[model samples]
Target: MRIGIVNDMPMAVELLRRLVVSTREHQVAWIATNGREAVEACRRDLPDLILMDLAMPEMDGVEATRKIMAETPCSILLVTASIEANVAGVYEAMGHGALDAVDIPSVGIAGNASSQSARLLTNKIAMIGKLVRDAPSRASGRISVATDPSPQRLVAIGASAGGPAAVAKVLSAFPIDFGGAIVLVQHLDAQFIPGLADWLGQHTPLPIRAAQEKDRPQAGTVLVASSDDHLVFKSAQQLGYTSSPKDNVYRPSVDVFFESAAQWWPGSVIGVLLTGMGRDGARGLRQLRDKGHLTIAQDEATSAVYGMPKAAAAIGAAVDILPLSAIGLRIIEACGRPT
Candidate 1:
């Protein structure tokens, strides 16, 4: 893939450059020190993918991404150190057509700098490449259709690093009246909970809203995990949104929600782990599979960040590992009439 990287931090630039070189599937098409230069570079060269930094001098990544999307319409993956602090801005960038954001890697990890960076960069490049190539058309293809007569099955979704766009793609494919409660756990900040919900609501038919404390799962709605809260299920299928005071490092943790649903919903749940950067959902999805629930992992071919789902698949957690486009159909089929 032809790639462009735009960031002001020399350390970040070096790390990403090393990673890109190691991937071998990617070529650094351009390197810009700021968003203005990034926009100009993209406009002129039209690289297939861009690794954009959120904070930079002389125009921010958001505006530059907007302009690049307007002019060149390529993929922009945000490489940032402060994803928690910029949830709203990141969502805004995704809404403006930036494909995904990844946490900036530390330069001091214990490995050969170039080789390690190259591996990291290669994984990200491939993930975002697929999302950029596939998500736009998938988003455009969403429609509301009548649900078939099947048991009331719930949709369980999990995501991480570049999950926002993937989550939007899956949900936007369904109508507001799509039969089943949709529970989503995306690693995000408590501060940007409202914005994330609101942003997704504007693009999908389902009422994308934050999961309220003690609320129950219901059909015709999409429930997002609140910032800093692990959305769990209580007795009789009620929602439990509470601070995760345990050892979990991820707020709005996917593992907790997926595990809780595995216990509470049992055979009726349909679990999905989409594009992400970590293994948080792997164990939980495994639990769901043990309980006879149907589980699906987004295949490497259609993931923006394949870490989470790939991890799940590695553990044999999924009944199938399919592309992004086929996932909605699988969910619809799961909610369809019995044979």
Candidate 2:
């Protein structure tokens, strides 16, 4: 991968340069001292991926990520000094389409250039590479549906790219007595799932947590996919994980979970496809619609990346294509209110 480095600190830039060049699969494309420079450099010569730092002189990473994604869209990984300290900003940047975040790794003694953090960065880059190189292609396998009656209503959501904040905003609107069981399939690393749930729990009235193995989605609570493997329904009412489609680049794929819900969930369903970079949820959402479930897709004007929802709209999968603000109320209208 041709990687770009963006940081104001000279030492940080040098260290990132060394780190990026350490592996034979990667090469340094260009360097930017600030967010503004990074955006400009991207316009002139965009790289395969960028290592973006949060704090800088002219512009910060959050703004740069927003600008870059809005103007010249590309892959960005937030390589900041302290992810713990910048948790809010990290998600904010992600809301604007940054793929993921990681703290800068320490340099080894005498410039040895080897550490656990180094390995971590390498692994993150490798995963992001797969996401960029491998777009979602549909498989031919079919999952069987159950005919048994289950009284639980369901709300299944899929998101990526700029999903964190969007999901938070939508979930925040659901009242405490919200009637439908909620499940989220966001494109993220397994390590970040708990943090994402905790962060979301803070903003929403609903209880939020990572979905455990064999857990069933319950009303008035949110369950998130907790593993890198695809979250699925083993039975009509039993949740489980599977690695059957190993070729998918998006771990915890939305399509897998949504399709599982479409096939298995017996009650009323509302499928929502939020902002994302790819078309993972579009096909699954279509399946849900074909089953006569109410489906919603975020409109392109309000979407950060607009790829997933746009695909949904293109195929006439969404029953209502709405802005982010309008989606929650629609779900509440369908799920919270009894007809």
Highest lDDT against the true fold, candidate: 2
lDDT of 2 by residue, 1-339 (tens): 999999998878888898889889899999999999999998999898999999888899999998998888888899989987887888889898888888887777876445788888888899888767653421101112222223367889999988998998888777776777889999887888877887888888778989989998887778999899999999988899999689877788999988999999878789999988768899999999999999999988888777788889889999999999888888877754442
Error of 2 at 41 (Å): 2.5
Clashes by residue pair, model 2? none
The reply for model 2, stretches above 4 Å from the true place, is 22-25, 110-112, 134-151, 336-339
Model 1: residues >4 Å from true position, as ranges?
A: 1-32, 35-89, 92-151
lDDT of 2 at 18: 85
Cα deviation of 59, candidate 1, in Å: 9.1
TM-score of 1: 0.64
